[model samples]
Target: MICPFCGAAMEKGCIKGQHEMAWLPDDKRDALFTDAHLQEGAVLLASSSIFKGSVVDAWCCRVCEKLVVEY
Candidate 1:
């Protein structure tokens, strides 16, 4: 993929996490949890089980130091 910001060649990769991974709107708070529970309206990217974690396909632009992901 080509980076939309800089027209640079993007690299294919996967985003991984041990526990949970998600994308939230910029207006939302950084806290993903409230009183030990998950907040609403989070776009879950990957979730983990007892044995393994899930991965989401993504493209990274090293030139712009940006990452693009689809859930």
Candidate 2:
């Protein structure tokens, strides 16, 4: 995929490290539903599930150093 931010070519790759997302409350989780935005002050619901890390297929733009993940 071509990076919309920089118009640079993207290469398919996998992230090298473990990536995690917090389990947030409904209101906080809704905030992230819009687009690729940052999550702040989010809490993880550890009592519910133990596994929180994930891996995904992604394309990276080396120029901007941004990653686009494909679920």
Candidate 3:
């Protein structure tokens, strides 16, 4: 993918996490969330779990040090 920040080429990759992965709002207190109680605007990269990693597709731009992911 092409980076939107610096007009550079981006590398396709995965965002891995031992637990859940998400982009949460700054004002939010805890990262934990259930499917029924998911916060607004929270982009969940991976679901919460134990002993298993979560992998999400992402694009990284080395030039701008930016990462883009889709939920």
For all predicted structures, in order, the TM-scores are 0.76, 0.47, 0.74
Q: Provide the lDDT at 53 for model 1.
A: 73
Q: What is the per-residue lDDT of model 3 for residues 1-71, given as tens digits with 9 covering 90 to 100?
A: 88899999999998887767767678664644454127777777777567667888899999989999977
- Which prediction has the highest TM-score against the true structure? 1
Candidate 1 lDDT for residue 23: 67
Q: What C-alpha lDDT do the candidate models reach, one value each? A: 0.76, 0.60, 0.76
Model 3 scores what on Cα lDDT? 0.76
- Tens-digit lDDT string for candidate 1 (1-71): 99999999999999876666766666665664442125566677877666877688899999999998977
lDDT of 2 by residue, 1-71 (tens): 89988999999986432345344556667674532124565543222224634444679999999987664
Candidate structures ordered by TM-score, highest first = 1, 3, 2
Displacement of the residue 19 alpha carbon in candidate 2, Å: 7.5
